[model samples]
Target: MRPYPSRSYQAIFWLVFGGALAYCVYGLIVGDLYFVGKSGRGAHLHGVPAWCFTAFVTFLGAGVWMREFSTISSRYRTRFEILFLVSGFSLLVLGWNYSP
Candidate 1:
């Protein structure tokens, strides 16, 4: 495909995407203030349980892997990218619609 029309735009996208992935990854590990463990009170920002948030974060890992593969055009590892995109979307749904 064609390179980004603007290098700055691409840079911004990378920053945002990567940052989001990083945030979620870190959140999964840190959990939350009140939510200390499985028995603790897990908070829900938009409706998603903190545990589910962690699950969604795993998708970012896939996105990161795909980004590395795509950067070098290594064979057909594009599936990771697709997985990332789909997972990200699913995250939004869980975040917004999850009631329990």
Candidate 2:
């Protein structure tokens, strides 16, 4: 396994991670982190809940990226990365579209 990501891959990862972090910050600042149902009702996901969700996504992504350079066996890296990515993105989507 490579000790570090290629320049292109690093660039892409940072772009995505930065966007996610920015979006979280924006949502917190605007106090508009929520989801509205078709029935006109809304569920608020601000404050602690928003922070928790943001932290979860942020850390998950960071961990996956950092894991690429770890000393662990490469045999499971791909599987682990896939699992982390899918679960992380799923949670992010769920948080964006659903209420706790």
Candidate 3:
């Protein structure tokens, strides 16, 4: 289905992208680059920085979701909205619970 010709989706997409980009910058400035650590077995491994990576992935994923979300059909609208809300809420909860 063709996407509706509206700028709202683009605005949202850019908003998310910009926020995530800002978070990455903040992470860098605030010394939150904990992307590597030792495991239980003492093996060094590179880990994903929770907040930074989450925001990064969300930024990337938002593009795809917004593309689908902007479509003219209503078939996936509710689902996308739910997904966006749930994912966003869950991220907030996770951040709150596991804040450093």
**Candidate 3 ranges beyond 4 A from true positions:** 1-16, 25-30, 33-69
Q: Which candidate is the best by TM-score?
A: 2
Question: Could you tell me the TM-score of candidate 2?
Answer: 0.56
Candidate RMSDs in Å, in order, are 7.9, 5.5, 10.1
Order of candidate numbers by TM-score, starting with the best: 2, 3, 1
- C-alpha lDDT of residue 79 in model 2: 70
Q: Where does candidate 2 stray beyond 4 Å?
A: 34-44, 69-100
Q: How accurate is candidate 3 locally (lDDT)?
A: 0.55
Q: Distance (Å) between predicted and true CA of 11, model 3? A: 5.5
Output the number of the lDDT-best candidate. Answer: 2
| lDDT of candidate 3 over 31-55, digit per residue (tens) | 5643334654332112234563555
The models' CA-based lDDT, in order, is 0.59, 0.71, 0.55
Sort the predicted structures by lDDT, highest score first: 2, 1, 3
Q: Which residue pairs collide in model 3, if any?
A: none
Query: What TM-score quantifies how close candidate 1 is to the native fold?
Result: 0.43
Query: Which consecutive 10 residues in model 3 have the weakest lDDT in total?
Result: 40-49
